[model samples]
Target: MTTVPRRFEILLVAGFTESDETPPTSAHALRSAVVEATGETGESGYPRYAGNGMEADIDPATRTVEALLVDGAEIDYGLSVRVVAAPAT
Candidate 1:
């Protein structure tokens, strides 16, 4: 089976809040859950969203992080982002 890269276009990100008391098992799980929670749909046969490398710092204080960068289109869809967080600089 071909391995899907850790990077893909994030089509949508829905705002949500989960009980932080319930800890995530692994970093992979956390990332996957977050991506799924975003409500992203990588649908084919439609205008597919593309990923842009723009990113923001995670702030535990703010409890909110900037959404991923997606190719801006006039259509009604939201932004897309990389599936995995970019490597630390």
Candidate 2:
């Protein structure tokens, strides 16, 4: 039997911390980190950073920040990469 290539949708989740002296991480910085680690680039030889409609769920109890991958292509502990099967048309 012939092998069929499978399509996948990759999602990345990361967590960070900031203090009174330090500012929050920027999208560009996150994208750059991902590119540096994975070597995934776009047409401009760099990954796209999308912050539109980006939502973050912060839990005070756990002190965690969770966000869903929404727009654009292309994060930190070095990136939690999740690859899932693409939906069929």
Q: What TM-score fits each model? A: 0.22, 0.27
| Candidate 2 weakest lDDT stretch, 10 residues | 31-40
RMSD for each of the candidates: 13.4, 14.3
Q: What's the distance in Å from true for residue 19, model 1?
A: 4.8
Candidate 2, superposed: residue stretches over 4 Å from native: 1-4, 15-75
Q: What is candidate 1's lDDT per residue for 31-55, written digit by digit as tens? A: 2222222223323211122334323
Candidate 2 lDDT over 5-65, as tens digits, reads 2222333435333443533333313321111112223344323222332322322233233
Error of 2 at 25 (Å): 24
Deviation from truth (RMSD, Å), model 2: 14.3
Q: How many residue pairs in model 2 have overlapping backbones? A: 0
